[model samples]
Target chain A: MTNTLTDYISGYMDTINQQLEQFVYSLQVPERLRDSMLYSIQAGGKRIRPILLLMACEAYGGSPNRALPVGCAVEMVHTYSLIHDDLPAMDNDDVRRGMPTNHKKFDDATAILAGDGLLTASFFAITNHDLLQDEEKVYLSRELSKASGAEGMVAGQMLDMEAENQELTVEKLEQIHKHKTGELLRFSAVAGAYIGGANQSQLQSIEKYARHLGLLFQVQDDILDIIGDEEEMGKPVGSDETNQKSTYPQLLGLQGAIDKRDYYANQAKEALKEAGVDSTLLEEFIDYIQHRKK
Target chain B: MTNTLTDYISGYMDTINQQLEQFVYSLQVPERLRDSMLYSIQAGGKRIRPILLLMACEAYGGSPNRALPVGCAVEMVHTYSLIHDDLPAMDNDDVRRGMPTNHKKFDDATAILAGDGLLTASFFAITNHDLLQDEEKVYLSRELSKASGAEGMVAGQMLDMEAENQELTVEKLEQIHKHKTGELLRFSAVAGAYIGGANQSQLQSIEKYARHLGLLFQVQDDILDIIGDEEEMGKPVGSDETNQKSTYPQLLGLQGAIDKRDYYANQAKEALKEAGVDSTLLEEFIDYIQHRKK
Candidate 1:
């Protein structure tokens, strides 16, 4: 299952990079600004968000290749968020994915504009797409905005920032992750399902599946922050604890948090079954996330 | 001409404010984040861009009220730019429209999220419109993203940032304003005419009118920064000079810049006539921007 999923992702990785590169470079913006944006896009993210979008679309009987641009658009949104979050005014991280952060490599001003450029370009990738129908563009734009905007990821971030130094209940932490991280994952699956023309029942089930997967992703992140390798993880660990930010392990004991990650995994499996998504690729994702080393 | 336009603007001001207020408060975002967003929205900048949109729509026989939500959406985008520009990494301004800048009123983290929230919400405002068709939404979204995104306003800001302490020719200065300030203004007119169902020729003419009007607006802004009263302008004058930022007034003589503003105003009027837009309100906008105190 893992090999099947890896092959699927590897097959599309080149296409994804090419399309994103061509798109960003094709823009008529100033050279320096364009370079900053391109730099972040070329940075080594796991590419999990976009790969999930393609797999979901494939599961819904849509050609995954056709969904490439949309997947790249999601990656842009993801990249933009990371760029903004790493700003000195925000999380202030100097490293990302083992390389200098956007603000570190480029100046903060350029990083800010680069983030802005990527964000605005995400919508352009959709609305100006030659292959997508206007209705699809409309629906995708609406969903993307809702998921990424104040109503979703941004709201969740605000909640997380405020949660620092204060004790948050497990339920409160879940709520934050559901909005901050979950919405985009939800968007990935839902968007893929939508682009593939899934029925309402299937869309609902995929939503459930993605929601669980999102929490699973966050829990693993908290766990890794405590126990992961510094070289493989690309940055120092325990920064969250240093910041005194509450996490699943802090609220739930380490064992309890591990138990919770398993519970969400089971829920996700159940939802996937209910949705009739029998793709080995998606199943591989579940297994991969649970046991991922980095 | 002035009174008619003033009446037209006053008639719609309350509606615009109410709609923005209602839409923002109704969001399920965190309270502090919501308050930060609302603070900037409620900040007292003249609603010139939105009013221009409504007037353009009305000139084409569409009801001004029908265009109000879209206008508010543009306002959100405008407000977001101001917020981001005022960030310490950007313009580092402390005051905007007689009050603390968004980063000044709230912390930088809150300010960044607030800007992101507003930027995302602006799209939702258009895509979720009760009165718009999917095709209309699609076209509007494409234009809005291009106008506000990297291809337009963001690119312009980057150009301006790079221009600091660099000698800029008149052509270079116009190029920056065209993207920075001009793109959104261009969107306002083009979107209004589009919503009003103007012919292709009419839309093109509106685009031309808007292009000139945009440059005219910037030239006046530059002139005001030099000669305008401080209290009325709500900030210190000569800040542009203090920054050593190039402007039309600096590149051209003060009187030369004023003359150039008048030239664009006349060009705007000619395009308006060609578009067959007979609105006294739009004509008055040309006069208003030319002599605006702020």
Candidate 2:
């Protein structure tokens, strides 16, 4: 946790939060729906996705200014997924990020609409972005739709629900997370690289880095669910065990999961090195994901 | 309707339904999730939206083949909206188009995922379509997002939910439908025209046509809900009245609503005439919307 790295993240987090708030508030939507959408955006997460997007863009020697709105767009989609995942019919969680979930705060209908609004607006955000070329916008939309839709996060969600109370082999578990988290994370890196004018080869290297990082994130998340501090996580731990849901820890042992997480972290660093990207911040991210309490 | 318009519609309808099925079935998604999506898409409506898109494209001198996939994309979004609207937390509908709703056939979670999948894939479909220019794809994606997102359909859905069981003046009611049905209808015509290479002036006239056509669709919908035959509509009539939902017929007397419908139809026809379009098919559409039993 170098002060410089920490400072960098904090600075971008503040900017991301501010811009996201402005973006949602400025929408010409029903006031109540806008509020619900803004509420979740403001309900704090680490803004890891958007920050990663910006860092990846910078690593490719592009200006962060160009990536800013695109980063926010990814965050919007991510927020929508979380809100829907917390619905009574889904994960049924009443709290997220230390606050009442959108459904709990505004009711299921509002939360649903809010999620819909956010997801639906994200493509517009990208295409309507003035800084990017029209062709760049097309690529982003195509990749984004893949990352968020049936082929990606949503499919992962559906499979995860089906897997609840059922045994999942390690292969099946990895398959789930690859789509669930890996694809979006992959998009964060690859999209940034493309927008940064990286050639196809550079984009491929970044994709490799992101795939490993995504697994590292999920493995750590699974392990943290077993032993994470309740106060730090803002929710009770051991939820996976309670729900009879499979995790890397459950499928393998806890120590085994820890070993896998480190392996992914190392693999991610190697990919960054192979690409010869500006790896200082991404290397720190490897450490941060490896050791973060939440 | 003239035989030319009738034959034209039936011919395109077959191709639309066929390609839509192929598109959904071809996705490399989970079998169950894909099936759920296919179920709703195959659960027939009149394929009105896609057909309108095709007709508008042809009217503006575009080939139907080029507009085919984009039309499918619009229909996919429309279908997804219906699936989400039928959820237990939303409309709680049991049947649509004479078949069980997506949520009824599948569980709530699967239905949600299917809707999410369809909505998300639509952008990909547009961007991935080979026939359209990059510029056209960008235009369609931008318009689709606005039409489907917070500024449009989702906002309308949220407002309609809020207005449920509450008194709404005709102005408020029109505002809701304009956002709800209006934007998407506008997209169909406008996107088709753009892809067909219609100039700015032609596009504006089509926009006007679509605006009136959207209201005509809604007004007729209200009338059908009150007096439509169950067999003809393929669902029970009076459900809106049963739900105590606001409708044009409720806001205005039945005769007033009928007058409104005819007026909008006339206005839509005038717009088409002003656009100097090949208006034979669209003229039939205005009539079909006005007098269709369903």
Candidate 3:
């Protein structure tokens, strides 16, 4: 199942990359703005969000191809958030995925517009998706908006920024992660399920699984920041500490954070089992999240 | 007709403002972020976009109440653009509508997130609008995404930024205004028509009227920057000159700019006439655009 999942994801990554490239190039935008947008997207990451969307769809007996455009839209949203998060006014990061951040490679104005362009384009992608019914498109877009909007990811970002350099409780940290990272990931999982026409019970099960998976992903990220190798992480360790950001490891301690990750991973697996769907690929993803170096 | 239109608009403004206030307060966002967003919305502008949307719908025999959510949504998009455009990296304006800009009132990070929150919330508003059919909602959302996305407003903004301090042709300036301001306004007009089930020709006519109206608004803004009162305009005059922005007055002189404004205003009236819909209020709007001091 692990090998099969890996093979499936590798192929899906190629498809997603191609779709994204085509979408960006298809835009009749100013050359520099287009280049700036493509630059960040082309600076690849793990492509985890799109992969989860596609895998969830496949698990529910839907064709991955049918869900490809939606998967690509989620990736675009994720990419836009990362671009904005790296802006000078935000995280001020100089590098992303080992390359210069968008604002670093391009001017700050161009980077900001690039983020705007990508975010706007995500909605356009969904509205123009060829296969989905209009009703389905509406549902998918609404879910995406809710996940990305103020009460969700953006709120979390605000909370995270406000929490910076301050001691945070476990509840505050959970709130931040849930909004900042968890909502979008949960949306990705449920969006695929929605596209696949999963039954209500299946939908709820996958959503629960995704919630745990999202927490696990963030916890492991905290652990990696403390203990992971720079070569594998593609960024320096101790960034959270440098930024004075409260993280799972900061709140729970390194070993305690590891325990939290393990706990969520187990919960995720259990939810997948209870979903009563094909769980092999999702289970493999859970394992990957638990063990990934970066 | 002018009296009737004025009364109608005043009433609509109250309703729209109330809806906007209620909508922002309904969100469970952090206090600072919510305050930042609400501050700009509450600061008050002409509310031109939402007015156009509601009026167009009313002209097409649709219930204004049915289009109220969409009107508010367009206003949110407009507000978000203003917030982002005022960022230090962009226009860097300290004041808007006689109030400190969002970034000045709140921090830069809060302003950016607030703008993002508003933009994302606009989509959520459309999807959550209960009165419209799902298909209508999809169409409205698609039209909005196109207007606000890369090929439209954001593209225009990039071009405008890139063209700063450079000599620009009248044609180039037209391109910039069309994308930067015209697209969203055009969307506002046609969106209402779409919701009202306007025929294809009506849609085209409203789109044309909106294009001219959009250009007229920008031209008048330029003229105001040159010759209008600082008190009424709510900011200092000649800021366009100060910023080295190529405005109508800069490119074509003050009288030339006024002539241009009249030309578009007349064109807008002509398009409205040709549309064969009730044009009383829309005509008044055109006149308002042409002759307003601010």
Candidate 4:
């Protein structure tokens, strides 16, 4: 690895994967369910959600160890959502990150239970973390639940499904992605700030930064689905078109979508600057989001 | 409606139902998902889990209002489990409470998301409750997550699915029921005690009482599946036999199962008596478990 942002991300990914493995293995579930869950958690991703959490915590002067459990919890939530979204009744995808989707590797029943198990375990992970105070634990758990529950990610999915093949304005598209992808990302950033004892103004600034970054992430994903390589992206391109789901490029056109992504990225940087915290890593993260091919 | 235990239960049931209605309605989910979720929750069961929680709280001299949120939270968990269990990949039941199951009424995808929504909302309900201290909220959320997660109900369902069509020993059958049904019941009973400020010995006694009661409840369910009226039960009898599920009545003879039910009911009463708490409503609950037609 070179001394680039990619190298830094690679290091964080290694640590996050190790922590996730230990956490899932330590659960007292049956062997089959445990194996099924471990399969997906170990199936790799960028580990963006958790890494952002740790970086935010450190930038706000909290030890990364104190926020590590919350990071794992958010990752579990993300993994479980992916497992369910790829189910036959949902998006019906057969592959994720170049590996078979959970329902494909395990049966549908096991996959569903695995998702449920991970979702449930996320709360346990939050509450059982030893380093955080009880107050922080309660607040984080509540926020995570709200982000994941009917009002947030689940509702976003419902709307996305309902909006399939329908003409959508950019506003409606933003609403869908904001709830589906933004809420948990927002929670990740804000929770770390809370744990680090960030002031009210710092918390608000970090939340704004996360909101813009989340939108930028989704818009970039929309652009990638149209133009990215199949092998690098680890799945077929044009899935959004196949699903007839609304996308940023679909609403704003290709050039327009690129401009939107850049706009959000700049807004995110501005928020970070306004927050006036250590921004070296977060700035790198924003740049990575801007230029990643996959 | 008299001052008898039956009337008291009826009152509690009404209050719980209303609270559940208000909570689901207040959620910011899309209208369709909200309706689907409300449909399942409004489809009535005995509300045994939430009722047990409230009764235990009152027994420990805590006002039931203080524990109402936890009651609703447990009920949401139970409702979500039922929704998932009725999926085509799982139990595949089409009818529940004399109406279409969640998946049958809605689509499979909607049902899955609805279940996920409720499960996520459950933790939110626990932590967002205003009356409890942060410590109690954390403890209760952790307990609920453990009871509902892989090590508990989800694991039991997996074991049950795997055990189908295979002859299960009495020991294995006990293990399945203990995780599948007993853990949530145990949490309900013990959480109330904790919130109501029970002493250590009192908590133990209630936990023991709840364990016996949980097993007794399952044994009776198995017996009812054989002999109870479908109209009263609101679903077909003999589902266990149809599914090739091992039940107490299958592992032990009918008479033996009945004897086991009586034994556990008596043991529950004994534990309650030893605890030296108000036993009027709890004793009635045990009797109800023994003799209810549904």
Candidate 5:
């Protein structure tokens, strides 16, 4: 079952990655900028956001192919954020995905524009997809903007910068991560539900699941930053601490962090239960986040 | 009459600027990122893009206020490009709108994030607006995305980057500027028409006008870069020459550039005439662009 799930998810990811590359290429990006964008995207993260989006769509009885555009859109938004985050002004990290960051590989301006390009491309993807209704497309596009913009990831990033060198409570940390990272996750699930024609109540349930799943995803990330090997993680470890940034492992002890992860994981499963839909794949994803080493 | 037109455009801009500031603030932008975005937006340009969009809408008998969100959206996208363009990797300019650029004022990372935030917020603004039918909103959103994304402004920018220090002919320069700078201008007009429920022929006429207007806009900009006063322009003159960037004035002599501006300006007015709409405001604006100092 685990292997089958992996195969299913991987197959979906491959389709998404392929279609996404084609979309990016169709933009006719100049050689240099194109190279920079491809550098980060092709650097090989797990395509976690896209996978979640596709899974949510599938769970709601939508074809993964139909959902592929949204999957690509979410990942584009995610990759764009990562490019900007790795800039000299933000995380200022020299490496990501075990390769030189976009800014490091290209110039900062190109990296900045590449991020802008990706973010802008995401809107086009969601809006241009022919299979979705106008209302569905508009709603998804709106939700995406809410997730990626100031009130969402950008605001969270601002808070993260300010909170650096200062201690933060668990609640504050959650607030930061929820916006910086969680909002997009919520958008992915809710958008999938929307495009799949899920009812309002069903969407609400998916939101609950996404909310918890997003929190757990970040927590696991924090844990990995501490415990995972640098080679496997593909970026420097303990840099979060080195930068004086707050994290779950910092607020909660190692054991406390694990407990929190379990708490959220259970909450996610409960939300799925409320959804009253078969979300076995989503459940497995939650479990995977809790257990993944890298 | 000129004063009345100026008042009309300026009043509309003042409303948009106020609304833009408010809309951005509504997102809970982190203090740092918020400061960066506000600094660029409030730094003050001519507000030409918004004014053009408003005039187009008004020309078609659409309420300017109803079109205000689209105005703000284009300006946000424009401001984002300027922010990213000033980064060390791109144009490396130290100033814009008479103020230090975002990267200089904040940091490279903050500037990049601010640009990212602003770009995402553009679409968010359009989607969240109350005016327009659901179908219209979706169409509007898609058009704006195409204008801003890889196929449009991004490609233009990529071309700009590639052409630097290379031998670019007048035709290539026009092609690059058409997408890089003109596409959004075209969008501003098209968006207004879309909001106004323009018929196909009306839209085509506006498209023709916009293409010519954009060409004239760029030629004038290039002319200003060479001959305009530093104090009047609010940035150092001749930076384009210093950077060895290609422009109309570079490819064509000064006299030729001026002639091109006039030719395109006349063509734009003619297109407006062909549209059979009230051309009073648009005509005045076109004349203003032909002779304006900044």
Candidate 6:
């Protein structure tokens, strides 16, 4: 099942990568800025956000190709956030995805503009997806915006920045994670279901699944940041500790964080069962999220 | 004619301002960021881009209300650019429109996120506009994307940044200005006319008019940067000089820049005549672009 999930995800990513190249090729970005956006986005990663959206759509009986635009859009939003996060003004990271971060390769201005360009372009990609009906296209575009904007990812980022060096209660930390990482992840599943024309009950199930999956995903990240090897993660470990950011590991002890991750992963699996999604791919997804080394 | 244009433009602005306020209110941006976005956006500048769109639609025999979304969209895109341009990595300006810039009022990260949220939200707003048919809405969204993306505003900005302190010819300067300031302006007229369901020939005429009007608008802006009073302009005088950026007044003599503005204005007026648009509002627009003081 794990192998099957890997094969399915890799296939979807290849297709998505091709489409991304085509979409970006149509734009005549300055060579410098273009290279910067391409460097960060094109550097290989798991492509989990887009894959989740595709899988969610397929689970709802929609063609993955039909949901490709939303897939691309979620990835674009994720990429833009990563680019901005790596900027000196933000997280100030020097490496990402085993390569120099965008700001490291390009000047600060080009990196900033590249992030801006990618962020703006996500809507263009979603709205321009030719397969969806006009109304459906509009709906998905709005959903995508809601996921990325002030009430969502941006708000989450603000909380993360503010919470640095300050002790945060569990509730405050959960709210921050929910917005920062969970909103986009939730949107990935929900938008896929929406674009795939899932009914209300099915959507609710997918939403439930996505919510816990997101929490589990972040908790795993917290664990990895604290103890994972730098080579496997492709960056220095313990930077989170050095930065004094609030994390599951910090809020809960290491063992407590692992326990919470298991609870959320179990909840995620239960939600999928409630949704009646029959794919073995989903079970494999649960296993992968919980046990991945990187 | 200029007085007539001012009246027409201001009336359109008054209506659009209400919609702009509603959009900002709907964002539920954190109170601080909301204030930051609203501060510069609501600050009193002529709503030239949006009003131009409405006038063009009106000239093409469409209802001005039908163009409202497009009007507001261009303004949103314009406002986003302003917000980002004032960031510490870019112009690093402390003020705009007689108030502290978004970054100055809020922190740099919030300002960046606000600009990004606004940028992404523009397409969402265009897609969600209730007035247009599904097809028209799709087309309008596509056009806005083309105008705002890397080949348009983003690319234009890159060129502008790269040209600073470099010897830029008139042609390079025109290319930069066209993408930076003119693409959105051109899209305003073109999009409004398209929404009005203009025939192909009429669309062509409006496109020509928009092209000339957009360049004329920039030429006048360049002129004002050199000679306009700081009180009226709401920024320091000779900012282009202060920034060591290239501009029309630098490439051409002051008289030459003035002559070029008049030439483009005349061409704009001629295009409207060729389109056989009976809009007195559009006729006056040419005059305003040619000689307005602020």
Instruction: Report clashes for each candidate as comma-separated counts.
Output: 0, 0, 0, 0, 2, 0
DockQ of each model vs. true complex: 0.86, 0.89, 0.83, 0.92, 0.74, 0.65
Which tens-of-lDDT digit does each residue in B1-294 have in candidate 1?
A: 378877877888888899999999988899999999999999957888888898889889987766888898999999999999999999999998789998899999999999999999999999999898889898888899899988899999999999999999999999999999999999999899888878899999999999999999999999999999999999999999999999998989999998999999999999888898676888889898888999
**Window of ten residues with lowest summed lDDT in model 5 chain A:** A1-10
In terms of lDDT, the poorest run of 10 residues in model 2 chain B is B1-10
Q: The CA-based lDDT of model 2 is what?
A: 0.90
Per-residue lDDT of candidate 3, residues A75-188 (tens digit): 888898998899889999998778899999988889888988888888888988889998888898899988998998899899999998899998889889999999999999
Q: Tens digit of lDDT per residue, candidate 4, span A1-294?
A: 125666767777878899899999998888999999999999999888998898898888999889989999999999999998999999898999999999999989999999999999999999999998999999999999999889988998899888888999999999998899999999999998888778999999999999999999999999999999999999999999988888989888999999999999999999999876888888888988887889
A133: Cα error in model 3, Å: 0.8
Q: Write the per-residue lDDT of candidate 5 for residues A85-162, one digit (tens) a residue.
A: 877777788987778888888887688778878888888888889888888888889899989888898887878877
Give the alpha carbon lDDT tens digit for every residue of B1-294 in model 2.
Answer: 667778988888889999999988878899899999999998989888898899999988899889999999999999999999999899899999888999899888889889999999899999999988888888899999999999999998998999998999989999999988898899998988888888999999999999999999999999999889999888999999999999888878899999999999999999989887778888898888788888
Candidate 1: which docking quality band? high
Candidate 1 per-residue lDDT over residues A1-294, each given as its tens digit: 467877887888888888999999888889889989999999867888888999999898997765778888888988999999899988899999999999899899899889888888888889888888988999999999999999999989899889889999999999999998999999999999888889899999999999999999999999998888989989888988999999998888889889999998888888899887656777779877876768
lDDT for model 1, on a 0 to 1 scale? 0.90
lDDT per residue, candidate 6, A105-188, as tens digits?
887788888888887777778767878888877777777778788778977877787788999987898888888899998999
Provide the TM-score for each candidate, comma-separated: 0.98, 0.99, 0.99, 0.98, 0.96, 0.96
lDDT score, candidate 1, position B19? 92
State the C-alpha lDDT per candidate: 0.90, 0.90, 0.90, 0.91, 0.85, 0.82
Q: Rank the candidates by lDDT, best first.
A: 4, 2, 3, 1, 5, 6
Better candidate number, 1 or 3, judged by DockQ:
1
Better of 1 and 5 by TM-score: 1
Query: Model 5 over residues B206-288: C-alpha lDDT tens digits?
Result: 99899888889889989999899899988888988888888887778899999999999989988998887887888888888
Native contact recovery (fnat) for each candidate is: 0.85, 0.88, 0.76, 0.93, 0.84, 0.60
Error of 6 at A287 (Å): 2.2
Off by over 4 Å in 6: none
